[model samples]
Target: MGYYLMKFFSWVACRFSMEKCNSFGKVLGKLTWIVVPKKRKFMAYDNIIRCLGVDAGEAERIAKASWVQFGPMLMEVLRYPELIKDDYIKKYVTIDGLEYLQEAIDNKQGAVIATSHSDSWELMGAALAQYGVPLVGVAKKQKDSAMDRFINEYRTLVGMHITYTNGVREMFKMIKEGWMIGLITDQDPLWSDGVVLDFFNRKTNCFVGPASIARTQKAPIFHGQIVHRPDGGHHITIYPPIFVDQTKDKKEDIKKATQQIANLLENHIRTHPEDWFWLHDRWKSVREKGLD
Candidate 1:
């Protein structure tokens, strides 16, 4: 049932112009917010209020807007087949800080891009690939095989090299080949595996994969994000790279690099509250372990 539903939506999205699809997606997102269960629904609101220090009214507004963006996000992802057309990237996606990415490629030293689950986040990597950057995105495999296959196909279709979370060896190979690697680091990691850090003033466990890779591989780490413009386009901003201090203790260096990423994510989310994936229980590890 889940697989068929995804296929149906993808089919519907492919048949419409992007503008039309986006408009329809807004309606779909609103309806989804209304129908999803209470726990799932309130999680977004809670995250906004507690983590962001927003009042209830403002948090609710931000929560709903995030939900609204979800529809357009899914629709845009499903429309990747059309997005790969010639000149599509040039028309809709504008990139800043190309020199940062270019520097890595030019030097034959691949870069680790630290990103989050922001609006049209998947599109960031795909757009770069479409613009001629050799990119491999680190992705978590969905539990449902159908959904996983559906997404991976489009990712590859748009020229993105896909690797699962456990494929660390493969990532090193890609980095050695000077291919940019995109890692979404916003989600909570298992308590045992993550490094606890301060996010929005709250303690939470964070994945250190991107930082570890950059330090070990001697690659530069750049913070990046894609924002949805008012005119329904996307603008990708990549900051200058930070080289992890090899002189520092290994664990301490990883923690420091990870903290820098958390700070960047907080800044972006504060500026664009609705862009981040608030639906996720970002502090789950802290809550589960009864950490203060």
Candidate 2:
């Protein structure tokens, strides 16, 4: 069932221009917003109010747009086989911060791309790789094995390597081989070992994997943020490389770096709040544990 759904979506994506495909995504997103459970819908709307302190009306609007945005972005994932070309990405997406990315790559130490669920993140990595940057991003596999394989194959087709969720060993190994690692650092986590950081002025558990790896490997870091323009295109910004403080205590340094990454994420999300994936309860840890 998953396999056929995947094929259907992929075929539909290939049948149209990127803009047209995105229009289809918008329609699907609207349908999903209507059909998905009502409780979950308000949960997201409430989350925006809690995190961003937006009024109920504005939060509701953002939450609705969030649902609509994902459909089109997921289409870009399916269209990877054709969309990962330099001409195509350049045509529809404008990329900045090349010098920062190049600076990270130039450093002998491998670099970690600290990116959040900003815009079409799949397209973010693919667009960079299409321009001759060798990148590898981690993915969470689908429950259906066939669908998982299909998705990863398209990711690789975009010229980025894959490390499945919890592929820590694979991630480090790829870094050792000089591959620039792209880590999605914005998932809500509940691990006791996770670091606590201020997200939108509220305390929550945050992923320390990128910072921990940066300190141990002496790698520089860059925050990748993308925004979908009103003109139906995307603009990607790669902030400058942040080198960790190995000279300080490892634990303290990791916490500081994580906080800095948090700052980057918060800034981007604040600027383009609608572009973020706000449906998930990112503050779940804070709510459940009370800033412990």
Candidate 3:
């Protein structure tokens, strides 16, 4: 049933124009501001307070507005199927740093592209795949296996491949085969796999997967994001590669690489404050432990 629902919505989105879908997104965004639950609202508020050093009232306002942005982000994912063609590329998304990606591909050395949970990230992947880049993404499996399958299908249709987060062996194989890996590096990691890092002026735990993977594979890391312009168009930027020094001290190199990625994410989120998904409990564990 969910599969059919997603497929039907996807078809509807493609049948209409991207502009119409964004118009619907605006209405959905307003509705989400009014309807998100109190508990989730509190979580968002708390996260903002810790990360931004804002008082309760201001945090609440930002959190509410953030939820509004999330509505469009949700719609944007369903809109990915529509963006595979040239018409949609020119109309909605613009690539700013194609040279960097092209250079990496020309070198035949695999690259690690890291992005945060910023505006229409999934759309960024779709656009890259459409542009003829060999892209593969690492994704956590959704609790609902059917929904996961449906999303994987869409990703495949757009020419992006997916490797589950737990498939370390498979990921290594892809990297060895010279496939560029795209990963989201802004989420809080599980306690076992994460290291504490300073983010938004607070010590928060972040996943070390990007650094670990890069160190193991000797890959160059690049930061990229899709920034949503006020006019509803996306500007995708792929920055110059950040190389990890693989010296005798592997652990130190990992820490430095992870910190560099975190710093990049901080700058991106700070620049486009509203476009980020602020509803996540990014500082939850620290707050719960009374450490923030």
Candidate 4:
């Protein structure tokens, strides 16, 4: 039932121009909030206050904006098949720091695009695709099979290759081809398998895969953020790549790489608190699992 509903929504989203679709998305977001803010409101409040270190009032404001962004965000994501067209790319996306990404590829070292859940992150991939980068991204499989297929297919509508989180062999093959693989380095990883890192002054388990991959593949790590402009367009600012050191100590290398990624994400979130998705219990590893 829900899958069909999403399919309907996707079809409707693609019918309108990107600007009109985005406007409709904001309306949807407001209706969603007014009708059913849902239980994530509690978690969103906690995350903003705990992670951003803001007062209750300020945290609530940031949390609300974050939730409000969902309408346009969902619209943008579902509009991928429509938005990835060449004309839309030139009309709406403003790309900067492109040379940094190109330079990494020029070195013959595959680059791991260290990404996070930011405003309009889905568009980030499409924007890069417009620039002719062979994109490969890793994501966890959705529990709903039909929804999973629907989502991933649209996710790669702009020429990206989406792989499951456990697709190690395929990732290795892509690395050998010097493809740029995108990994979200900020998600809370399993305490047992992940390394502890300090994010927003709190210790939590973070995925070390990007760092490990870079070290093993002799690749460089780069990060980007898609900031939503007031005019309804997005500007992607790609940061320079950070290379991992071959210090002989594997764990130490992982620690260094993970910290670099963590620090970079923290800075972006700090500078733009409302732009980040803060609904998830990102500190669960420390507060719940006692990773600290």
Candidate with maximal TM-score: 1
- The TM-scores, one per candidate, come to 0.94, 0.94, 0.92, 0.92
User: lDDT of all the models against the reference?
Assistant: 0.86, 0.82, 0.80, 0.81
Residues 4-96, candidate 4, lDDT per residue (tens digit)?
Answer: 888888888888887887888888876777654456777778777777778889987887777678888888888776776656875688988
- What's the lDDT of the predicted structure labeled candidate 4? 0.81
Runs with alpha carbons beyond 4 Å of true place in candidate 1? 1-11
Show model 4 residue runs off by greater than 4 Å: 1-7, 34-39
Return the top candidate by lDDT.
Answer: 1
* TM-score of candidate 2 to 2 decimals: 0.94
Candidate 1's residue-wise lDDT over 94-204, tens digit each? 999988888778888898998998988888888888888889988889999988988888889899999998898999999999988899888988766679989888888
Residue 41, model 4, lDDT? 77
lDDT of 2 by residue, 95-146 (tens): 7897777765575446898898868887888888876666887888789898
lDDT of 3 by residue, 45-69 (tens): 7777766777999888776666676
- TM-score for candidate 1: 0.94
Ranking by lDDT: 1, 2, 4, 3
Global CA lDDT of candidate 1, please?
A: 0.86
